[model samples]
Target: MISGNKRTERFRDAVAGFEAAVRAQDADRSQQYFDDLRRYFGEADDQDFRQAGPRLAAILDEMPAAPRATVAVLVGACVERGADPTPCAPYVLAGLAGALDDARAFCDRWAATGGGDFPDPQAEEPPEDLLDRVDPDLAVAWLTLHHWEMAAVALLDHAAVRTALDDGTRTRLLRTLRSVEEDSGYVFKCLAYALLVLDDEPLVVLDRPTGTGYALRMTGIGDNFQLHTLLADVLIGGGHLPGRAPSAEEAAVCRDRPGQVDTIGSFNLVTPLGDWVWNEGTPSDIPVVDGVRLLVLDPPSYQRSWPAGRFFPHMKGDLVLERVLGADEARRLLAGCAAADG
Candidate 1:
């Protein structure tokens, strides 16, 4: 950890660089600064963040929205980064006050009830060279362990998700992998199947066999506010309604952006909250969905803000997504798979 004053300086530098990047209209630079800010919180002396985080959040929040990512990421980073230590829990919880009121309340409720750590286990070490050959669906779970933490700990006992996996036997999956992230076609497909089973909605993956344009067949639309964008990023990173999924670089572009949607990526999202927009390098204020599977995308890309409320898979926005499917299509695919198993 960087020592006291130096840690403070690092915190200031991150906020300063981000603010300057936004003011200068440097999209990429602002993104870099945001990434640095996240890193500072993680690496700076843990206690120093207790002082700098809220101040940094206030400063970032005051900046113009066009050049900066959302203030929530900055604030969320503070809470998550400081979460490792038991003593820092209250301080970290304090940082989540406004942006993650739901999460803060959860912390209170969970604490008052005498519990800690969500359903997800903290960390595990795997034997060397063991994780390399893990099944793709398992590989996806390992990746989720890194990105989303416990929110990715969906039940494996579910019949549909279990049936969807390539291997019925757990042999050869000896290692519990951590820190390795490789995209998997199986992970993409299985996540879709699992999500469809869980949502129990008529989900669909709006996509073509080739090229871009991806989203869900959404209904009973409501305000996306926070949950939709976070889910979109996680869904994409894990692979989504795959008309065409994002390449590695494209995923970075979407995750780093302040709002939902990226100029370069191929995916768009429609959530009950709102639609994921600005798809295929076009700025579309109003959505255009014509076909039965037509997509109306959401505009804000994924950022971390509501993890305390269990809103996203990752605390920060850096990972890539692929092999995607939307809700309606996911349901359809699962049905087919179930029939085949039967």
Candidate 2:
């Protein structure tokens, strides 16, 4: 029993650490945590780990996503090494599918803007009544983010990624031929970068400097962490940048409602899923090699987040921060700008 308790403690820690890495959007941290998990896996016998599979799966699913990319690789490795993960098979597979869906969505969303193409800084109209479903601010954020992603995808597909690859390599990194044939293929890097950037959304901004504030160079809008929070956690923090974060009293007035940022100390229970399930556990199945392939996206093609260079040298990064305005107000603003230029 003591042994089991110790294992559980360590396992939970490892899982928590991995999830934290993912949320932090640091590949190196994620890899290191995964390595810790692998070491822990070896500490116990195959049957021992297998018995805990369901628990692990439940934990992983509790989070906003499952770390499918890592779990899939771990499962494959265990199988190859003659370890039986049967007890945990169902859980692992569940996490794998969920993680893959999130990854695919994340990547496909942003990769559309890859290569030398640029995201249109200008905002566009939403589909009919889109604002009714979500706040005007959130609606605009989604449109802008989606546009940038589309531009990225175009940049990636335009020979920059394909210049040096056997068909197999390209397929693995981009899509299997079958998927492309069926119009179902998606880029691995797309999923990877999506998660990375989104993880970087909820920043811990202290008044005092801490290892350089969340400049969020890659994203547009100086101090634009709020938009990412809306996307990643599906709730914006309570406060506007030009002003202080919302006060507890102010937040109390607006709590439990959509279309508003949350209070700083507010309970995270009001997440998109209506509860706090974050950091319970996360799984990833993307192999180290695939992660390496995503290195090209490390640098912000448009902003200054990474110390790395742009994936598309020909493309230039421009800040694309969101600004809210009514239809008439927008027209007036544009007209004013045009006149000023003239």
Candidate 3:
């Protein structure tokens, strides 16, 4: 076992090296330092690093104060390198708590510098019994952290519900989102919300006319992170109702709908507006008609390796559609439609 002092020295050196490489704009060097940092945390093995959570947490606690973004980057880097910090869920949670505290502090400092009254930033305390509720394995912890990180963003912004973030931070957060793309719809929604909040321009939500009902869509220059979250919130908050599940009747009706419906797999149907899945084997090509409006969730990528049917399970009378396209794809599709309309 490594001595505490030795571990501390290793962490500090690794952090310093990473920072230096970033400053030098040496992508290769920065990545090398990141690898070193991961190795220091016992992620040298191909196995998920979640087993090393305790060690990783101890090292983080020993470090001197660092910037909120820096902390996010470090943790993110570990995640990117496949180090599962789940076993150290408590430590990861604590780290998140610390980062939130740091964000509040930074905001306060900024307020003071501007001579403005400090906004009573909300304090988000991670659930004390998180470990009790979640497994301490790396995958579980990764999912848990993924959930909390997005929640932290909302809490930090006081559930701004409409606040935007700096471009740099937005990009960094999106990169992190990309890493967790294969996780679940819940993770994707959180990432989308983060991107929406970080965008520098105005966004509009559009609803596609499907038969008599409508499906909501978001149009923007960059990632439509907000739109995805909005869709998720709508689906979740709408109670995943039994009526929402596409039925054989609806599928037949959808076939004649505006967009062509291609069955991607046993469970899913890819439509122009959005993808849909059904518990029954019969696939439907449904268009977003009425009753669908984009409402901000106020919450909230990757080639899926799993088969479509197994990937999205029917949950309590509802089916989940993972993101079929990224922001750029959505834009291109919409742009082509607009051109044709013109």
Candidate 4:
């Protein structure tokens, strides 16, 4: 049996050989090296893959020209075997730069025919003909990455690639992706929310107490005023729902409740006296009740916010939320943000 160290060394050697072949633009030698890399990938345990993934990613980063077909195969294999696909993102994005026009055109045609919205590839399988209609290289990358929004989000990350496209083309692609993003029931929902909350903190309510809830302070990303967005963040980033497990820290802090806390389900923003500050359709000119002002954060959902409706799969019950920021507050916040920027 090959010792772990020896196997690791061989994997590194294969990566180096692959990089050298790519640098020299040698097709046959590249294939031979990639075969060895494939064998290593096939045999990699979790520890081995985590260690090797970064190295492979580093090589792909340096190689101006890579064997796109083999790279797709390797990335696809990584995702198929239940390993992280992050390392493959650079290569996927590189290929996507060339395929964006093709993807955008396909999406435009699909929308014209009333295809509606795109689904999360992880939670829901895409249509059989979907990949067939796209550029072959783009389809392969998506197939391996197991995401439709991957290309769109990847394009956003690569500013050079994104700006190279004509403004009209970029806008069309982004608009299509945004529509798909809104309807998705999984991680993409979190991503959409992140985009919405860019450069501004949103509110989030943590429902530990049964009657009154604890509102988390707006500090950083993932902490949003919207419960759905916060829940989406929890599900995507932590790989677990908030209701499923109570934090030991939360249990310690929530002393008013003797038993375990239930933090899931629909919530309402209320005052200290348990009066409705905001829930569902509360209307615009929300009066300052009892001399306290509320930080209103009612962003649009898959549908309008009212009477609590079901949208994402991660939710246990319906959610009824308040209205968006009022005109004065919006101006004040934006002005403050601008001043900070200046």
| Candidate 2 per-residue lDDT over residues 22-140, each given as its tens digit | 56666787777767777686555555445444333334433322134335444434433333434444444344333333334433444443422222324354355443444443333
Best by TM-score: 4
lDDT of 2: 0.33
lDDT of 4 at 15: 68
lDDT of 4 by residue, 56-84 (tens): 54455344332443454454444434334
| Global CA lDDT computed for model 3 | 0.35
- Lowest lDDT 10-residue stretch of candidate 4: 310-319
Alpha-carbon runs more than 4 Å astray in model 1 = 1-44, 48-203, 208-247, 253-314, 317-342
Off by over 4 Å in 3: 1-43, 48-50, 67-75, 88-90, 110-210, 214-342
Single out the weakest 10-residue window by summed lDDT for candidate 3.
307-316
Model 4: number of backbone collisions: 5
lDDT of each: 0.35, 0.33, 0.35, 0.40
* Candidate 2 weakest ten by summed lDDT: 292-301
Candidate 2, superposed: residue stretches over 4 Å from native: 1-39, 64-68, 75-87, 111-342
